[model samples]
Target: MSDGDPADDIMTATYRALCTHGYADLTMQDIADESSKSKAALHYHYDSKHDLLCAFLEYLYDRFVERTSDPAGADPAAQLRSLVQTVLDKPEDDREAFETAVLEIRAQAPYEPGFRERLTRFDDYLAGEFERLLEAGIDDGVVDPAVDPADTATFLVTMLTGAATERVTAGRSVECTRRMLAEYVESHLLTDATEAQL
Candidate 1:
C-alpha cells in the first residue's frame, strides 16, 4: 500500500484538479489519474472523497498561515493593511474552489467535530493576529484610544471576509473590491487623531 510515500504528490494534484473541476464534479478516479496513481493507491491514503476534501482544507489552511506571517517591525496600521490585502489578493481561480470547499463542509461541520474544531482554530488565529495589530496601533497612537482593539479587530476581519466572499461568489472585480475595502478601513478604522498622526 505504501509506494514511495506518494501521498503528498497525490494530494497536491487532487487540490489542483479540484480547483479546476470543483468538488461536486471531482471524482476519486479523476484524482488518481491526475496524480499518476491507481485508484486503489489513492484510496490507501484517503479512504473517501470526504476525507480528501478535509485534507485539502487543512492544506489550504497551512498554506495561508505560512504566507501570512507577521512582518517584523512593521507598524500596526501597516500590518493590518497587509493582512487585508492578502485576503483580497487570493487568486480568483483558487478563490472559487476555496469558497466552495468551505461552504460544502460548513453544513457537516456540526456533525464532524474535527472540522468544527479546526475551523475554530483557523478563525481564532485570524482574529488574534488582527487583535495584535489593533493593540499595537493603539499603543503607537495610530488608532483611537477609545476604540476597543478586540472589537475593532474582529469587525475588520469579518468585514474583509465578507468582501472576499462576495468577490469570490459574485464574480465581482477583485481590484474594485480591494479598493473599496481599503477605503473602508481607512475611513472607518482610522480616526481623525490617527489620520492626523499619519
Candidate 2:
C-alpha cells in the first residue's frame, strides 16, 4: 500500500494492537481502537483478519529491510556496529514486547508459506549484509584473510538471532547481550593485527 493509504493506517494500528494484545488475542476491534478510524473503516480496507495480518507481516518485513538496507560506507567494523545497535538499542519494555510479538509471528513461518518466504528472504538479506561487511574488512586487512567471509557471516547471523531470541524467551538483559556481542566482535572478528594497527 502507498504511504498515505488507509491500508497503511490499518496496518500501523495492527502493529500497536499486536504490541498490546499480542497475536493470539489481537482482534479487529482492538486494532481499530488503536487506529484513528472505526472498525468499519478497518474492514473496508482489510476483508479479514488473516488478510490484514498478511499485510501487517509485509509491512514489518519492509521496515526491517529499510532499517538494514545500507551500511553507508567502506567501514566494515562501523557497519557491523550499526547493524547490531539497530537490533539491540530499543527501549527496554518496548523491545521485549516487540521481540515477543515478532517471535510469535516467526513461529508461524513453517505453517505459512507467505511467512516462510518473507522470513527466509529476510534471513538471507541479513546474511548477505554480514558477508559484505566481513569481505570488506578482510580486503581492508582489518579482518584476517584466513577467515572465510561466507562462514563467518553465517555465524554472525546466528549469533544475532540467538541473542534476540534469548532476550525474548528468557528475559535476558539487553545491555548484557549487547556487551557480549561487542566482545565477541572484538575477540573473534577483529584480529590482533587490526587492534595493534588501531
**What's model 2's TM-score?**
0.81
Q: What are the per-model numbers of colliding residue pairs?
A: 0, 0
Positional deviation of residue 102's Cα in model 1 after best superposition, in angstroms: 4.9
After superposition of all CA atoms, the RMSD between model 1 and the true structure is 4.3
Candidate 1 has its poorest 10 consecutive residues by lDDT at 189-198
* Residue-level lDDT tens digits of model 2 in 1-198: 236767677777787888888777778999999888988987887887777888777777787787677845447777776777776555333545656887888898889877777777767888898888889888887776777889877887787788778878997766776777777777788664233211
> Cα RMSDs of all predictions?
4.3, 3.5
Quick one: best lDDT, which candidate?
Answer: 2
True-structure lDDT of candidate 2: 0.75
Give Cα distance to truth, residue 66, candidate 1, Å. 1.4
User: Which runs of model 2 end up more than 4 angstroms from their true locations?
Assistant: 1-5, 36-44, 72-74, 91-95, 192-198
Every model's TM-score: 0.78, 0.81
How displaced is residue 122 in candidate 2, in Å?
A: 2.4
Scored by CA lDDT, what does every candidate get?
A: 0.69, 0.75
